[model samples]
Target: MSLRPLTKFGYLGRTYKFFNGETLYPFGYGLNYTRFKYSMVSSSHALQLKFGRLQHCRDLTYEDGTARPPRPTVVVDDITCGKELDFEVDIQVQNVGNVDGADIVIIYSKPLVGIKETHIKQVFGFQRVFLKAGENKTLKFTFIACKSLMVVDKTVYKVLPSMENMIVIGDEELFLPVQINIASCQN
Candidate 1:
């Protein structure tokens, strides 16, 4: 599968509607024999200030003991920029069906800045949870506002402050709004 954002498909994404038009299935598409319901318990609509960019990211190790670069890491202290904004959302998923099944929860992000030549939306996080019939679970996700910073022309990387960052769940069926305010650092 193409890990590049859905919008990168160009005509395939627009004309074929691979990610735009009406389709039978879309990215991260899956089906389960049971029904599931999702509810927002708490969501952060504002960003919290932090000191710097992410540092000391450990390589992700698989079950086979292989390591992968770009391991997930938390933001750390740096002085090049002002406080970094952090956002998070908590969601509750319940299996209301009669039999046990698994459901995959996908998280997508859209930056509302005027950045040109970027994906319509990008998938930031996802997880699969299995639950018994009528079981429910709570999942929490933390994303850095700077994580969505875009690199254009393979040389310039820019962070757009005051950009409306939206956290969408499950095909836009649900979403939480968060704003990144780092106007002091913007040029």
Candidate 2:
């Protein structure tokens, strides 16, 4: 019996130009790597004076399944005094299993203070960090608050520091508790 052209499974829309009945497994296919660990060492949050928004505030998440709900730290932003602040998010990637694997790092920031889901940026910033057999990598990411967040009405500003108002991290939004004076918030 003959099969219909349209009904037949063909590689008409696949990335590869050719198709065959036999399954193809390219090199590195099915290759699995060992699990690694990632952790957040420290983080800082502050409100920007000129931008009227939080300066250099962000959330860190490790690719490791065991790592979640990364801890956050509040830091002072005194750029003038050469006190530049950068969140040194600590992450560890280890190959727990016999086989080695690679992991991708993702950092998400949402204005949980005064912005809604619609206002948040899509495709949260991401960084790819690779790990080898029984190896780990410590990563650091600097987050700068959106400039648009500044100049918001004072009423909106009040929303900050309030648990109700904060940047959304992921599905579970986290409202970090922090207060920054104008003098110390100069970035």
Candidate 3:
């Protein structure tokens, strides 16, 4: 199918999602004379955040005020971002090459399978650091799980519990698996 019809999703021409899909070059595709190595400095479970079951919208009628069969929808205003969902990931980037240079690190989040019509991946956070040859720097990326981790299903914002959230870095796809938990929930 032509991606032209997915105007709502914008152009599928760019590699905003799937990393392993057939493509010449995708997001974070860049060339550099110097090479960098990325290693996780934080705990693998550092991304633990809270999620809760979604509640359906109370307005049962259609937008035009016509009564119809009830459908699952989220109340846009009712959605709240709690502190329980804030987390951070720390990664150390070392310039392994013999030349000093600056590199931009793009953090991409691969959506959990439970969400439908989801992007193959989405940008979470990014950082650019200039490191001397053989120098290494630690970069901290903060994420409000409710924001970057949220997905709109049927036009309503919601977060679902999943252990499949994947974070990829740079031109190379480094898989970082994270578990999302439900805690101190707000109804």
Candidate 4:
């Protein structure tokens, strides 16, 4: 009796779609051989700073040299929105002695105070970096916020009933938050 079926594999269909140009996707794409490292050089306090430490997920554990979930991660240093803050992030990327590689750096922000949930605001920028074998690259960033734009209270930005008295005295306090993301070729 024949142990194999007569049906073709799914790979064939995917391959055709990739090369046909009829589809928007490319075949054998998204494959990489090199790796990348990321490091912050500095940022402008006028830009608003945001960053965090890298850590593994708690739900994942290794018993006998096994892998786990929630791999390498970048945590955000929560900051109050609308408030001005000055900080810097330094990062370095070294080729793991394999081959050439690249990386993409992303930064984000959120509202710190008077927000029900911490929602992602906007993307700072995308940095495309390349590295050579055994070579390391560094990056620095500075961040800041505009008070006029960040103050969520209508009184601070405009005029509110409750803020009338405070407006007369002066401007109130506000805080703005920012986030960071680092992705390597390996990930």
Candidate 5:
């Protein structure tokens, strides 16, 4: 039998996707020859922002961990949408290893409010950087709501009045939701 069939997860198999119900460690999680430390250099406070009504032409379908069927994820078009509510965050990465090495810095985030029960943190940004044995660098990451947060249809953006009015950044979860009172998306 294949490794998938030998494990106890059935067809789901033993993979990073099903790390929760099982006791297996997360992928890439183990002792490394070199150690990397992460710290919060700075982050913007969350705020409550308002947006116009969001319009969806068709229902998108795809594999979503939260939903047995599927869920909505932003595409490239809406991901590029810009607004004043967007913010930036800085993270300090230090290579505490005896030898030089490179590491990829990943940025994860979640809405103070859940996005259709997709509560797990989703990646928004990442950058590959190299460092010396004792080198430390500050990386800048932009918190684009359209890309990382928020839901949209075909055009325009929408905000849920009942949703949590705060944006939570990973690491410290600097929650400061910007409430946006959207009238409607009529066009």
Candidate 6:
């Protein structure tokens, strides 16, 4: 006799709905009593703010077990092909409501090219920033472009560069879009 593996459900479970027309208040859903606005700031370095330091900022090996040198952090507009780079986005969130409240900031990333079997979008990081009425705060999110290419092969995990990476930020009503190019590393 043969038996099937058990299935999971809920937020991070495999049976969760992540697309349109499926359901309301999908994953990472939160309600706020106040209104907030988000805007991207122009800066030389993608990661300009120094409020907190990144815990993991280092080079990673490829699937073939080859070591690559660490790439320098540069402005988002200057990223080119063949360069392993780390970048960040600075978003300003303002509480335009009349009362004090908190807003949960969620960050998600998806690969333009599908990697056999993987989630449509995965949460990489998130932060909950509390703001008083008419208060504005800037949150910086830094990410290594290549680190999003993780894949599971058999029982071992490997990192492979994707053609393009799509980053999304969950705000009040707007979803911020940021694209990263990783074509050069695929060759």
lDDT of 1 by residue, 1-187 (tens): 5322344355334421124456787677787899888888776477544333433222112223333332232222322333444556788999999999999998887644333333457777788889999999999877666664322211123433344567778878787887544322211
Model 3: per-residue lDDT, tens digit, 98-119? 9999999898776555344445
Give all candidates' CA lDDT scores: 0.57, 0.34, 0.62, 0.32, 0.49, 0.50
> Residue 80's C-alpha lDDT in candidate 1?
34
Tens-place lDDT digits, model 5, residues 1-187:
3212222444433443222244455443544568788776664445344334574222232223434322223333532356654677677888999988887765654443223322234455778778999999988877655555554322333422213334433333244344433222332
If scored against the real structure, what TM-score would every candidate get? Answer: 0.65, 0.39, 0.69, 0.34, 0.55, 0.57
Q: Score residue 159 of candidate 5 by CA lDDT.
A: 27
Looking at model 6, residue 71 earns an lDDT score of: 30
lDDT of 1 at 184: 27
Show how many residue pairs clash in every candidate, following the order shown.
Answer: 0, 20, 1, 26, 17, 0
Output candidate 2 Cα RMSD.
15.2
The prediction achieving the highest TM-score against the true structure is: 3
1-187, model 4: which lDDT tens digit per residue?
A: 2122222342212232112125453321234576544433433223323333332211112233444333222112223443333444455556665887765544443322222111213333335567777788765544443321132222122100111011100011112223322233121
Q: List where candidate 6 sits over 4 angstroms from the true fold.
A: 1-21, 42-84, 113-115, 149-157, 171-187
lDDT of 2: 0.34
Candidate 6 root-mean-square deviation in Å: 10.8
RMSD of each: 11.5, 15.2, 7.7, 20.1, 7.9, 10.8
Candidate 4 local lDDT, residue 41: 41
lDDT of 2 at 52: 28
